[model samples]
Target chain A: MSGAAEQAPVLQVRDLQAHFRTHYFGVNREVRAVDGVSFDVNRNEIYGLAGESSSGKTTLIKTIAGLLKPPLEMVGGSARFSFLPDWDAVGRAPPEVVRAIRWRHLSYIMQGSMNVLNPLRRIKHSFRDFAWRHLGGSKAEFDLRAAAHLERVKLDPSVLAAYPHELSGGMRQRVTIALATICKPEFIIADEPTTALDVVVQKDVLGMIRTIQQEMGSSVLFITHDMGVHAALTDRLGIMYAGRLVEDGETPEIFARPLHPYTRHLIGSLPRIGDTEQREGLEGTPPNLATPPPGCRFHPRCPLAMSVCTTTVPAMIETLSGHRVACHAVNPGMAA
Target chain B: MSALLDLDRVSKSFSRGGLFSTRRVAAVKEVSFALEADKPEIFTVIGESGSGKSTLARMILGIHTPSSGQVRLGGRDVTTYDRRAFMAEVQPIFQNPFEAFNPLKQLDRYLFMTAERFGGASGKTAAEEQADVALRQVGLSLAEIRGRFPHELSGGQLQRVAIARALVAKPRLIIADEPVSMVDASLRMSIVNLFGRLRDELGLSIVYITHDLATAYYISDRLIIMQKGVVVEQGPARAVLSAPTHPYSRQLRDAVLTPDSAGAFRAIHSRQAVATPGVSS
Candidate 1:
């Protein structure tokens, strides 16, 4: 993390537009899932991406990770990794090139930990399958290294012998974290890793992630809809709405003074143990990506929406130091 | 003279495998709680996965009979009550609204059926009237949902429709098992707020089963924290949540991440968890 490119971000995503293009009969529909999303994961920092379902958070990550299939196409722009300077996006890169960096330089801690592991195979096989090739080690050496990795996260070494189903949900999550961090990738994509686990286990898993991330000094693009987890785990937080980044800044600052209306609502509406105050849920559903509203996608539901908001898309402006918000009402004069 | 719902040390054990090697798994073990007929309040059952929270909800709903003890609803055993009569008194709001309502079937059918069967609506017009009333209770109109499939409505709207279906029955108690789990974070409050309204306005006692502690504190009047089919803590929601005595309860409380808990990454990175014996082990 601290070398010649120490100042440079590990991952730079710029004006990335990935759409779900579907064609049936005479109709051609393009659902802009990641429309002009731009962000940077700086070296050794946790950048949290927050958004509701269909806000394009998943699409944005998958695009960045180059996990694209049919109907899901990287329409335009680039998500350039520092290691792969020649290539724009992993999606656009050749398979051999893409395959070379996976698990060694880049990895993912997926949401469903159990699904990530083979149901029929022992847990050790997952290690062998995902990390074995990257490490190029003997079976016994890989097993030993995997066991040590598991132990680093405070899991018993015995867990390696058990099947995915045999281990508890929390343990599997820990294993996933260990697996993702084993190679010490410069940047890790953690997609809602703690959302399914119970509060107690969730905290433990989060702590394990923090410890490992700090130890490895790797950048993480942690994505979750839970604001609480964002507040706890991330260094910087970005709020997404309808395939666009609405606001992003330091986690504490965002929590202290949320600039975007949606961010404000998200932070405010969270039910805490001590607070019994009435919190209102936003009206209107998340817009259909296939046919989003004109101008600002959030205008239809934004409580502070004006005529300008309905007509013009808001640019991401630095309202406060390092705090950028995309809202017409927030940045009235700064239309440029 | 009668409690709205009572579970006198009720336990449920599901047998596994065949006769060769039978194993009995106690999903709910010796759990006891009661909601009074005279009072209407949200009584929450909080637990994580495999904690038997769902199993307990089933027993209360009369879907699963307890292996031991009694589940008396309004001074009578839930198993003794006829299915139709029982459903009229207690309605369930499942976790996922998409799965709760048949996607192929129109949303109005559920509301209409509930109206005719449990709501005591005689004619087509009467059923329509009942459905409309229930829909209004959840802040939606029958006209908007009329002839619309489950897919047509959003997750929040479909969940509201499910609630409306529950309301159509005019049930004395509503057993909502993780009702807002599938709904979006932004829309979760609307469904949760609707529960508060149901308690205050409609005077319906709700047994809200969820693992989320924050929401439990927000809506529940009383709550019992469960761990592996055992109640670890039980008291008024505010008192218990604010200062949980049990180790498991304390751990659950401490684990909750909130906006206020945001701290400097370097300074307040990760705290060494205070070890709780017999639990974390």
Candidate 2:
């Protein structure tokens, strides 16, 4: 992770930590969901975050999105979005600035687009409500721009008249994409955008995302646990474990040669189309984030564990190419 | 080879709209397949949202009554079984783990309930032991999960607990409805692999329902592809997936995003279905 200081990372997360501290009938405990993780999602680049359930991938994304609520608290570190550097600054920018930047500078496309759409309103109304104000155009012009964006994503312009319920699952997702991209935001946070769609629909949605990102040159913080999806769509990938990014690198290199034992197990377990090799699943469960295992959190289940692995946490090591991994067995020279 | 579970021309319809303008929405139309008890293979039912895969699964579990045809379990009509008998012979693993179990209640309660209700356990000790055994089968322990609520555990752990609860009944068949879709990517394989293990080791026949062709290709032995209530393709999992004869099946196979073929996936979906477009919702 060299030369991290010189460049102004679009999303600079330094020692970013999030914890789920809870009191269970007077038993106070803290699950370190995102602990001491550091990474930079560079401008106009797709940085992929991969982790299984309980690996703290979702918690990390939620923190980045400034949605820390309830037991989930940002205990330590900083998640500084280039646009929103401070917590208080969010939603407090000058009306004109916020209006101009919100849908135009930063946008998010969620897994289930239905969440963003109002079922009662026609699909076009949802777009008008969010982007119309920022678009700074006449009603006719705004409608025209929205429709053009829809066409770019291969959605029929007629979809604007139909309610969210009237459209198919795939169509609703494409509408959400159009809504997010209509403003041509420089940064887009996509959380498993195609995870819910069918195989065929997933392909179409992912392809649209790839095409639009390439054409627009917008930075995307793509979060999903599916390595296959990550490998297919992301240019760079980061592996999250117990809330920390244990590995980060080019997607192709990570898929071809994973260094972390956990990453190895994760990639090895993926079932290919024609391959029949019996793959062994990782044993034991992910540590309870509220009270995760000591030292290397993955030591209990990692195939290659040492005595040091149980006591001293491993630092993220740059082994080969641009690949960085965190594991005592894999990178033994790291000073913990 | 005798069929363990069979669906013959099964159809499910829901009446919507006003009294005069009642519209018949066919969720599952003429879907048919057979799972052999002797084979004990992972049979996959793949479909998108409106494809009626879930509806077919609910019918198999006797949760929903089919409008026409029959759903047979172990060569007996599924609808014929009363509530108690139906639950004991078949079990279901729902998609969302958080929604599958009550968030307020302890996770062990479901396990104990399953043991007492279906496993014929006599006392708390026996039921606890049975729960522990089932948990162990899924690579979990009762001690760690005994008192945890749905929120306390991760989605993968909760899903594993859901699968364990289904297994306590010792049912001949299990119907997993998008079991791993809600789970994290890394944790997905463990759950899918458990299905294969259960079939091979315990002789449990599983009807794995999912939209993910990668995991389906990885775990399933045979599969039935569904599109808007119709079985578009049905055959051995490998044969059907590798060399799909049907256009819809081929589209599905090509739409799957692998590491090497991510860039070309959209072209596969561009060729829209030439068949009549049904109501997608």
Best by the lDDT measure: 1
Total residue pair clashes for candidate 2 = 3
Tens digit per residue, CA lDDT, model 1, A114-220: 88999998888888889988887789998999999999989888989899998888999988998898887878999999888988888888878887877766778
lDDT of 2 by residue, A197-284 (tens): 7777787788788778756656789888777788777868998887778899878788888889888888877777887777665676
Q: True-contact fraction for model 2?
A: 0.43
CA error at residue A319 for candidate 1, angstroms:
1.9
- Runs of candidate 1 with Cα error greater than 4 angstroms are A1-6, B264-281
User: Which 10 successive residues of model 1 chain B have the least lDDT summed?
Assistant: B272-281
Question: Candidate 2 chain B TM?
Answer: 0.92
| Per-candidate interface DockQ score | 0.42, 0.29
Instruction: Compose the digit string of candidate 2's lDDT tens values, residues B139-214.
Output: 8999998788898777888999999999988888999998987876656777888898999899998999988887
Error in Å for residue B243 of model 2: 1.2
Question: What's the TM for chain B in candidate 1?
Answer: 0.93
